[model samples]
Target: MRKAMIVWGGWPGHDPDLCASMIRGWLKAEGFEVRIETTTAAFADPAIFDLSLIIPIYTMSKIEKAEALNLCAAVSSGVGLAGHHGGMCDAFRDSVDYQFLCGGQWVAHPGNIIDYRVDLTRPDDPIMKGLKSFEHRSEQYYMHVDPANEVLATTTFTGEHAPWIEGVVMPVVWKKRYGTGRVFYSSLGHRAYELDVPEIRTLMTRGMLWAARE
Candidate 1:
């Protein structure tokens, strides 16, 4: 069976545990042998490299230098990495290696919990196939993204909350490569319930499968 690991914990504001449970259920349904861990120590385990995928639900936490390097090496060696929102991007504020693996870092959410639109830039991509640009109500993330990312979706800031960024477009969803591994991220799902949104649900599930080593 394909193996996957979810290491969840950090700021409770993101409901990390709840989100981790939801993802676990989804992976189980997909026939994956999923493992769960609550600490960054899980990243340092050499066995991590054996997994087919890793889903991090940790947000705004610290990771030891050795742990971060092992995690990055696993992905670079072909263990897929997939996550959403702060769980992935906003995680490890002190680890540039982690941020680089994720392809972006959460810099700001200008109008925390506001209505916005997500525009599809690569509708033909497998992860986005048949999906349409839709209206969303949540934290519209303004991230510091990697230029090498294959941007899949984006949102434009109206500057109502942070006027300095008015009209700036930010990547909402993207896929990129970290060595031989596929990395996927989406800046949606501020709340656990937000994952239930049809568009987000589709994007996340498809993105996970897309990122998994095949």
Candidate 2:
């Protein structure tokens, strides 16, 4: 069976523990042998090299240099990495290497918890296939993303929230590569209950499968 690990814990505001439990159930339903860890030390364990995927649910936390290096090296060596919202993008602000592996960093959510729309930019992509643009009510993430990311979905910012970025189209979902590894991320899911949104749940689970090592 394919193996996956979820290392969760950081800000209580994001409910990392609750979110991790939800994702663990999703992975189990998909036939993965899932493991859960509560600290960054799990990242440095050499055993991580044997896993097929790593999902980091940590937001605004610190990672030791060694732990960060091991985690990045594992992904670079072909293990997949996938995550959503601040759990992934807002993690380890001090670790540039970790940020590099993630392909993007969360900067701001202009009008926190507001209504927005997510548009599928590459609807033909397997991760996005069968999905349509949908109305969403959550934090609309404005991120600093890698230009090389194969963007699959996007959202447009209206000046009402942040006037300077009005009309700016931001990547809502994207996939990229770190060495031979697949990296996938979505700017959705601010809270655990947001997964109740079918589109968010579908894309997140599909993206995990897409990022997994074959």
Candidate 3:
């Protein structure tokens, strides 16, 4: 069976474990073997690079290069990588190379928790097929992006968060090709209950499969 490995842990504020559990169930239902490890130490193994897909559920702080490179090597060789919100973007903020690989970095999401709408820029993409623009009440991330991302979906702000920036458009969902592999990321996940809803889960799960190089 193909494997889905989840590395979750950081500030509990992101509800890493809860989100990890939700992802595990989603992967299981899809018939993939799941592994959950709550530390950066899990990245210590070169063998993990052999796994089919990797899900980083943690909002990283400090990361070790040896472990981080293992991931880069794996994805460069076609192992898939995917994550949502701070778990992937905010992760390793101190490391520019990691940010380059993930394709974005979290800046200030003004007003903290706010209600926003996410629009599907490419409705036919498997990750966003059948979904429409939907409103959610949670933390809306404002990210600084890398140039290479192929944005599949976007969300607009109406000058509420940062009044200085009017009608700001943000890439809520995107994919990038790293060497022979594919990388997928969504900025939607902030709270655990977001997954309990069907539309959001559908967007996320399909993105997972897409990132798995499937």
Q: What residue runs in model 2 are displaced by over 4 Å at the alpha carbon?
A: none
lDDT for model 1 comes to 0.94
Q: Which digits, one per residue and each the tens of the lDDT, describe model 1 over residues 58-146?
A: 99999999999999999999999999999999999999989989999998887678999999999999899999999999999989999
For each candidate, how many residue pairs have backbone atoms clashing (under 3 Å)? 0, 0, 0
lDDT scores for all predictions? 0.94, 0.94, 0.84
TM-score of candidate 3 versus the correct structure, residues matched by position: 0.96
Candidate number that wins on TM-score, 2 or 3: 2
Provide TM-scores for the models: 0.99, 0.98, 0.96
lDDT of 3 by residue, 60-148 (tens): 57778877877788888888889988998988878776777788998978788888888888998777878888888777788899778
lDDT of 1 at 199: 87
